[model samples]
Target: MLVSFRLPLLNEEMDINDAAGIQALLEQLRSSQAWQEAVALPTAPNEPNIVPEPEESNSAPSASVAELLSQLRTEPDTSTLDRPSEPTPSLPKPTTPATPHLTPLTPTAPTADLSDLSRHLTFQQALPVIANLSGNPNLIQTLKSVRVLLTCLLELMFPSQMKDEQHALETRLMEERKAIVTKYEEKVKVAKTKASMIGSGMSKHEASMLSGAFHKELKSFDTERVLTAWDGLVSQQQDALSQLGIPIMFASTEPSHRESQQKVIQVLEGLL
Candidate 1:
């Protein structure tokens, strides 16, 4: 036996495999106004529905607005607002007067006298006197003649007294000589004591070497010879005075007289 079966279909249902039918149905729904209104899509939540209002005609402001604007346009009382509560007192500044500048005057040097220079005075002290007398030849000659006369008179009147004064000067010179010798000898003794103390801490050879050098220095330290040399110089000066016929005793007498004699002697020697 052969049997055939047919599937049942609904009147409102469409076949899922029928593309043409579905497209035609969509076109019909789009064309129908009633269908479009009935099934309209909802607006998006982010999109606002704004309606523009109509513009009003040009006119003046209201009475209250006009009064408010007039009040704003009026000027404020700045004088009262800017003023301080109390007025401040101002003090005057003190001024200092300028002092006058003064120029100082130069001082003049004092004049020196020829009679003030002496043999007891140093070469430095006699320099001014010598300079003053240098130009006056007649005055110098007169001084020399006076000194010669005075010296002759002194020698004739007090020969014994002059000799005693000369002896005293020699004695003083000898005492100075002894003092110098004693000073140098004390220095040598001190050097020897220092060397001995230092040598205690040194090698024998080094100590001996130092001792030799120290003794050699002492040998060359002849203070006695220096005194003798000074004595020779004094002797030479005395011999020169004797040759010139001027007494050494005259130098120890009146300072003014000795000064004049010295000045005359210096002039004569310079001429020679």
Candidate 2:
């Protein structure tokens, strides 16, 4: 097929009849200054070269090729394909307030008194008081009786300082002592009234029987009965005091126990 072209500048007609002629025409046009100027005509700053297809070809670049060229011109950002894209910005999550931890406190036990305990007046110092109160000149027996009295009184008054069983025992013994004293007092009153009736003309046989009954009652309700009960109570109390770790046997023992005992004694003394 023969392709004809009229050159505007040279005012000549050329025909490309074969491949050789087309090659020769391309070489001639590349060397010409006029062709060079037309080829160098700038279309856009950054764009692909778009040369028109030959008029002899029935297919004008396919739809795919045109679409591809359009995409290349529109979307020029292709450098990001090799490198990774920037991460999208994310919103920070809402923060929650922290709860505070609380600690519990322990309660302290009550402390004993000090100023009143400084007087140093306890059952140990009760020798003179005992001698005067009982009118007993025998020092040895009096001191022994004082200790027994002190032990019984200390446990009875300060049951809080003793063990549960010891405290219960002391409570029972004290209640028993109270009952004995009450019974003794009632018996004494009745005996005194009966003695008053002896001289009021009662029969001799009845008088003799009353006298024998009074003697028997007197023997039964004597100081020995109360003393026997107190002795037993003191023995138990001494054991209880030893179990409690209180060194009350001697005046020269642990001063802390003595001080605590003295504190309680001072309060009792004040009450007395």
Candidate 3:
């Protein structure tokens, strides 16, 4: 078919030069099955291995001329014959995984430990201590015991020039102490004098008769008992107060364990 068309173009001098005839010939060339079938490409190597049935496949171009003519005479089996064997579709290409935006580890400050202990004074209040000190003029032993405890508390709470203030406070304390002790001492002394009057230069009957009006107040929890208890109690209390004030590091940051320190607060408050 190609040889037949080229023969006319090749013989230029004997060319079919009428424009109408040439246009008709070109239109006929476009509608020709021979031209349409000229590009009968082979099945690709990657084609499916399925051997299609006779119904599914077209007859090869090498088929008999009669069968080819028969196929052309009929309307095409459009469903099977119209579409291309190979189809190309545009698709979005998959992209490379973008660099994982590594978030920089933020360095954090230590959390401020707002504990109950943190808000409290590291030592006892001053007024109650002063009032107790002022009352006991002759409470030499009690003051001595408490003074040692107070000295420790003061030194720990305020590392300032406490020694300077101690001298002045001690001087005044001693005067108050002496005056109180003396008052109690004189009262007891007068009581003794009246008791001594009972044992006058008279007989036993006269002493008994005079003693009828005499009376005495028995002591409550004694000074000795209080002092003994004070030693142990003071030591324990100081130890507790010291423990509460001290800062400690824990082994874990689990949320459940964070409130464990409140246990210490409860126990300390109970003791106080």
Q: Pick by TM-score: which candidate is best?
A: 2
Off by over 4 Å in 1: 1-158, 200-259, 263-272
Kindly list the per-residue Cα lDDT of model 2 for residues 3-62, writing each as its tens digit.
223334223333324456455644554455644444455556686665533233232232
What is candidate 3's lDDT per residue for 163-233, written digit by digit as tens?
33444445554575565556656655665677679884445664454344222111222233333443343
| Global Cα RMSD, each model | 36.2, 18.6, 21.3
What is candidate 1's CA lDDT for residue 226? 38
Candidate 3: residue 73 lDDT (0-100): 37
The 0-to-1 C-alpha lDDT of every candidate, in the order given, reads 0.44, 0.45, 0.39
- Model 3 score (lDDT): 0.39
Model 3 misplaced regions, further than 4 Å: 1-223, 244-272
Pairs with steric clashes in candidate 2: none
Ranking by lDDT: 2, 1, 3
Clashing pairs in 1: none
Deviating ranges (above 4 Å) for candidate 2: 1-156, 160-200, 204-212, 250-272
Candidate 1 lDDT at 118 equals: 41
Can you give the lDDT of residue 192 in candidate 2? 62
Best by lDDT: 2
Q: Model 1 over residues 84-173: C-alpha lDDT tens digits? A: 657667676776767778878777655653222243455455455556655667544433333221232222211333344545655676
